[model samples]
Target chain A: MKVANEQTTRDRIIETARQLFLTRGFAGTGIAAILKEAGVRSGSLYYFFKSKDELLVAVLDQYKGLLRPILIDPVEAATNDPIGRVFALLESYRGFLLETGCRMGCPIGNLALEISDTHDEARDRVRENFDAWCACVEGWLVDAGDRLPNDLDRAELARFVLTVMEGAQMQAKANKKIKAYEASITQLRHYFEMLESRAK
Target chain B: MKVANEQTTRDRIIETARQLFLTRGFAGTGIAAILKEAGVRSGSLYYFFKSKDELLVAVLDQYKGLLRPILIDPVEAATNDPIGRVFALLESYRGFLLETGCRMGCPIGNLALEISDTHDEARDRVRENFDAWCACVEGWLVDAGDRLPNDLDRAELARFVLTVMEGAQMQAKANKKIKAYEASITQLRHYFEMLESRAK
Candidate 1:
């Protein structure tokens, strides 16, 4: 009973809504579906969040917290090399796509296009999530030091990695095939080699 | 008036729906709004299309018709060099971001994430749209001939360009800024240079 307290209940709801939004999209997901999946009644959900949009904000906020702990740390632990870590981060997403059969894309990216204009609060949060993601990638590039060309804009390159991932994921899911995702990443790999070669 | 024929009414409805779906998203848009925007009554809309989904299919069909004429042809007119045309295609999207202040993204891309999963008909259409786009870019790469590395996967490179554009647009729209898109395209330009230099 102690484990199923207010905070846990609220977290459970947010997690459920986040998954639904990623797979089904914000507009397509119904409140009843969230309630059903979270195993909470309407009253319980209403207690924690005023509306579905608030739950979305909470989900996005949770994403900010999860990025480092969930996605980055595990990949970082697997590889100490900064450049390897970047690809490892991308591969982690590949693993998810494989598991889901390329059905879901980057959560933040999914919401970014689906509701960014209609939902202002969520839009800023989406931008924050993106900023945080690019920052992580940029930090790795900074750590790479002499490995990459000095003239290379690390921030821009980092964002490019993100762009590649989001775009690849969209294509993969749309085509229902992993090959589409692979093609994009393979080109990115070549681009990285060219950057490293120029540095040398 | 001869101008208001059945075909014109149908095309007008599709054009209005395409704009709304791109700007507002598939799930967020309602039939009434499409009718209002198209300046047609519900009877006329239903006369041309039986359901909202049918209208969406019509919009997607029109998209296939519009891509070559609206996007690629104009960009091709600007440059004879195949490589220049690739960047020109990307720059055209940048122009769109600039005009709309980074609001709407790639039309097919927006629908890909929004309705592709929920609507199978739309999903296939989205995939075909992506395939057609990639084929166009691939044709340009083939036209580039020995200018690029012989070993380079031109089909993969073509898809990568699409990935970069779609991803850059999504980021630009979410950030409500054009610089995000510019950063991605700039990085892509660098990648192109690397490929060309390697060939030389």
Candidate 2:
């Protein structure tokens, strides 16, 4: 009973922090704000997370886990054809962005933008997340049977795909237009098909 | 002489505010901090702008003006070949990101991420700045002759290019690797050339 209840409090603290962090961000969110929102006392908050930074990392880990299915699964499923898969990945992003009214810009992108200069650990985690994501992208390209530019390499293509999605999401969010994302993915698909044809 | 001094104070306040806003963000930055950095009093800050939001708009306008030549010039000059010009634009961006050490993200992107649901005016300005940038991209595609996909319009192509670049910048900033931006632009360029060949 003790372990179960302890776990519940910890989880509760983490969930509250995650929501506040996403809505407010690292530098902008205060512990008092989070404590008030969570209906937890300061002692309880400190019991779960020793510091705000630690709490943030937990928030990011939770966020990453939640976002994977929504962001990566659809693209990964299109593994049979890398080009189509890339487009599908982008479309999945579009669907999410449109659904959310273009709010909650890419979480990784958001953290990176906020913490890269100040927090080395948080910054590195953001980089690792992006690299892991790129590795997934590279897998899609490799499965495509080397149709992409040999000179270009999978790492480069991964960067390209990642860039388009992040940029499109921001633009779409800013403009409140699904078309911005559609435009990016459309060009990306066309770009990929071109390389595939050239290789053939 | 009085007008000149007044203009100097206003410019100083704006310049200081711009740096703080980019580094600390909208909510993270306070009027007191801006005044301190500008070496002015609270009363002086209020004299120039009615509120922080007004000051923010001014800062953004200033940023847009500053970015035009540095960000847009090379892309425009690369106009000799529309497809080539677009690639050049991406390359210029890579150079810009590397120079910044991937710390300060796209100012517009930063604002969009930080503003949340408030400051619709600031959000709209960011959108217009993005659209202006995209317009430059579309103009390049227009110059590409029949290189772009016939089915898709220039506006669509431009929007895609914008997303890729923005996304690439965001990812590269997160990863702290110049290579991330390079990979994205190269693939996008390859995609553009493929479209040209298909048109032939």
Candidate 3:
């Protein structure tokens, strides 16, 4: 019972910090805010996390763990078509923007831009999250087989998808308009169509 | 003499704040630090700018002033071919990453993700800077003429390019490696090739 209760407390702290970091930003968010929001004592938070930075890392770890469930699986279930899944994934982001009024951006993209220059451990974890995302896209591209040019460097193309998505989201959030996001995704779709037509 | 000197002091302060904001981030950087770095007193700094947010808007406006000479003109000087100019601009960023070991990502991108949720004025400024950048790229695409599909949406394509560049830079900066950035650029190039071939 004690172990179960302890694990729940830690997870609650990590989850609260994660949402706050995404919404409030890493630097803008304070340890006190997390404790207040989570309804946990500072003693419990400090016992689980050595400092605010450690809590951020814990939040990042949770993101890593949640990617497939939060990001990939829904899109995967929606479409088994490999290339289709790519766009489906983007469409989901579109819905996310709709719900948030284009705020909160991609958690990793936001965090990466915010702290990649200064934080070492957090930066590596952020990169790993990004690389793992690219890997998922790469897997879809691999499944794409001859639909894409045999010579196509799927790995790099995967990176491009990520680039467009993050860029689109950032611009959309900044402008508080969905048009920028849609415009970028439309262009990416056209690029894919061009590639697919060429392969034929 | 007093007027000219004051203008110099204000410019110096904006420049210092811009660099520090890029390196240490907006939230992490303090007024005292900006004062120290710019070698100006609190009264002097506040006399010119009301608050840190106000100072950031000034820095962003300065980026607007510098965009042509700093980003577009150099690449234009390198290549007469319109399409080539696009890639040249990306190459310049690659060089920037090489120099900084991918430490500081795109200034607007970092700011957009960092403050888009919280700061209304700053977010607008960031988006305007982004739109200005996309317009420059759109102008180049328009110049490319029959090389790309006439059916192509030049404006959205420009947005896509911005997305890719910002996204690629963010990833490269996060990982402190140029490969991710290079990979993304390569994919964009290939996408352009496919479009050109289709036009042919």
Candidate 4:
């Protein structure tokens, strides 16, 4: 019973830290804030995470684990067409921006840029998060098969999709408007149509 | 002579802060660090700018002023082909990644993502920077004229280019490799070719 309780406390700390890091950024957020919000004492917080960096790793791990359930599954459920699934995935991001009034973007992308210069371990984890997300999208493009050109590099295209999503989210959040996000998607759709036309 | 010396001190402070912000990020950098690096005292730092936020505005404005000369002129001088100029502009960014070993990406993009959530004035300035960049690229696409589809939305395509650059920079910085940057540009080139092939 004590072990289970400890596990719950750890989970709560991770969850609270993740939200704070997402909304306020890793640099902008303070450990005191996380402790207060999670209702955990300093000893417990330190017991689970020796430092804020470790907490960041946990948050990123959670993001990696949750990518399928929180991000991919809903979009996949909405569409079975492999090519359509790609856009469905993007549409989910668009939905996030609308829901959040463009206040939040991809938490991983935000951290990827913010901490890449300062932290090595955290940077590697951020790269892993990006790689995992890219791999999921790559799987969809592979499932797309000959609907895309035989010469098409699925990995590169998958990376491109990731790029567009991150870039679009940056623009949307900065401008406090969804139009920037939509414009990128519009162009991406055009690119996809062009590729599909060339398919044998 | 006194007025000129004061302007020199102000310029020195902005330049130092700009470099520090680029490398350490806005939140990561401190005012004391900027003053020390610029060889200015706290009094002098405050004499020109009231706060760190005000200093950031000055750095951003300096970036705005430098874009045409520091970014566009050299690329424009090298390539009269409008499309080629776009790639040349991207090449400049590639050079930055290679030179810094992927430690630095786009200055505006770095600030755009880092400051968007926390500072309204800075966020608006960042958006303006993006707008100015997009407008420059849009002009190139417009110059391409009959080389692209008449029905093409130049503005949207320009925005797409910005998205790719920012996204590519994010990946490059995260992975600590130039390959990610190269991959996005390769795909962007493919997209450009597809558009050009449709030209009348």
What DockQ, between 0 and 1, does each candidate earn? 0.87, 0.66, 0.88, 0.89
Q: What is the C-alpha lDDT profile of model 1 across A1-200, one tens digit per residue?
A: 45546668888999899888888888888999999998999999998899888999999999999999999899889999999999999999899989988888688888889887889999999999999999999999999999999988899999999999999999988998989898999889889988998999
How does chain A of candidate 3 score by TM-score against the true chain A? 0.97
lDDT of each residue in B128-186, candidate 2, tens digit only: 78878778777777777666556768888788877777777777667677767777776
Q: For residues B1-200, what per-residue lDDT tens digits would candidate 1 score against the true structure?
A: 45546668777888899888888888789988998888999999998888988888888988999999999999889999999999999888888878887888688998898887778897899999998999999999999988899999899999999999999999998999988889999999988888888888
The sequence of per-residue lDDT tens digits that candidate 4 reaches over residues B1-200 is: 37535669889999999999999999999998998898989998998899999999999988989999999999999999999999999999999999999999899989988888889999989998999999999999999999999999999999999999999999999999999899999999999999999785
Alpha-carbon TM-score of each model against the true structure: 0.96, 0.88, 0.97, 0.98
Give the number of the best model, judged by TM-score: 4
Predictions in order: chain A TM-score: 0.95, 0.85, 0.97, 0.96
Mind sharing the TM-score for model 4?
Answer: 0.98
- lDDT value, residue A149 of candidate 3: 92
| Model 3 chain B worst lDDT window (10 residues) | B1-10
Candidate 1 lDDT: 0.90
Give the share of true interchain contacts found in each model: 0.87, 0.77, 0.95, 0.87
> If the candidates were sorted by their TM-score against the true structure, best first, what order would they fall in?
4, 3, 1, 2
Candidate 4 accuracy as lDDT:
0.92
Summarize candidate 3's per-residue lDDT along B1-200 as a digit string, tens digits.
37535668888999999999888889989999999998999998889888888998999899989899999998998899999999999888888889888986688887888878888888888988998999999999999999999999999899889999998999898888998898888889988998998899
The reply for model 2, stretches above 4 Å from the true place, is A5-7, A64-85, A146-152, B1-7, B73-84, B146-152
Number of the top-ranking candidate, with DockQ as the measure: 4
* Candidate 2 lDDT tens digits, A1-200: 37535657778888887777766677767889888888889998888678988887787676657655866675666556666776776667666676778776576776677777677777777877777777777777787776765665776777777887788777777787777777777777667766776777
Q: Give one digit per residue, the lDDT tens place, for model 3 in A83-133.
A: 999999999889988999888568898899888877899999999999899
Model 1 segments beyond 4 Å from truth? Answer: A1-7, B1-7
Best by lDDT: 4
The full ranking of all candidates by lDDT, starting with the best, is 4, 1, 3, 2
Instruction: Tell me each candidate's RMSD, in Å, in order.
Output: 1.9, 2.9, 1.4, 1.3
